[model samples]
Target: MADQTPNSDAYRRGMVTRRSVLGDAHVDRAQANTTSFDAPFQKLITEGAWGTVWSGDQFTKRERSIVTIALLAALGQDEEVAMHVRATVNTGATREDIREALMHVAIYAGVPAANHAIKIAKGVYAEMDQQAAAKDR
Candidate 1:
């Protein structure tokens, strides 16, 4: 049987961490889209990925960002890769980190996958940078 000891504290911490890393708008949209069909899956990810894994002290958000980017690229998950690219700024992962991870993806995941991921990342990054610049000006 799955252990169901109420991990309220862990869940709270995970929510905070998830919001900080993914941003409030993204998180809110995800929550708004939750349905009977996907609610369980969403809860599972919140508890497992966010609460258990992401809440651990084993890796900084920056390190997690690098790993996530590479995995998404290798899996050909271009949409997820683009989302993470935008989240990188909040995770303290610079554009250099994205570049390095994409370079690794080129060798391991193949040039095609890396090329597509890089293009998506570049577009996301450019939009984010433009938004930041606009705010500053």
Candidate 2:
């Protein structure tokens, strides 16, 4: 945490929460790729998304993961949806939870958006399965 830049309480909490949700390897890669151009944007999400909202005690990580995936799907954030779908492993969001969220998306958002996100989720799950299988081998 000391190595993390921006000496703010929010940033510190954000880093911890973000790492817990996204995993150390993903966070490390993101941090490593940080540059002058996107530093501010990165900081904002860390503090706002992770530190403030995500750190709140109101919602469990699993609930948050489901809502996040649905919102990203509605917004057509393909990459974000895929990333969050993968994060479900850490967040304790089961495939059943995600499926229900996408069902909600299909009704409230659009069938096409939910359809695309479902495709993305299936691909991510398959990829995760492959990784797990590799680990067991």
Candidate 3:
């Protein structure tokens, strides 16, 4: 019924995009953990979200990352927020951009959600900065 299936170009593109943004280690762990039970769901997200949406030219990866941060914060998805926040390094979204996104979340989503996300962001950013510093040293 659909024009392009997951096994088509979309799947491959999705794999590349997912790996690029999330990094090889994270993607590898996910792939290794994948079983027949959730393979279809993973395929759907890979093909639909990563392949179709992320691979498109409408918005840069940075913009998508910013919006995704806001959505995850609003939804109180702390784990995903942490993961995507880390992906900001590849997506080119700055800490300031993340702060602004959290501000929007406060207004549209809720103050509590934004507050919790702020904590998560701070922790993740600190860890990332520390890692970068270690690399430099």
* Tens-digit per-residue lDDT, 1-137, candidate 3: 11223566899999899999999999888887877778788889999999999899999999999999999999999999999999998999999999999999999999999999999999999998899999999
Query: Model 2 segments beyond 4 Å from truth?
Result: 1-4
Please give, for residues 7-104, the per-residue lDDT of candidate 1 as tens digits: 57766777788898899999888888877677677677877788878778999999999999999999999889988889987899989988999999
Worst 10 residues of 3 by lDDT: 1-10
lDDT of 3 at 64: 96
For candidate 2, lDDT tens digit of each residue in 97-120?
999999999999999999999999
Clash pairs detected, candidate 1: none
Ranking by TM-score: 2, 3, 1
Best-fitting candidate, scored by lDDT: 2
Give the Cα lDDT of each candidate: 0.85, 0.94, 0.92
Deviation of model 3 at 70, angstroms: 0.2
Q: Which pairs clash inside model 3?
A: none
Whose TM-score is greatest here?
Answer: 2
Q: What is the Cα root-mean-square deviation between model 2 and the actual structure? A: 1.9
Candidate 1: residue 40 Cα off by (Å): 0.3
lDDT of 2: 0.94
Q: How many clashing pairs does model 1 include?
A: 0
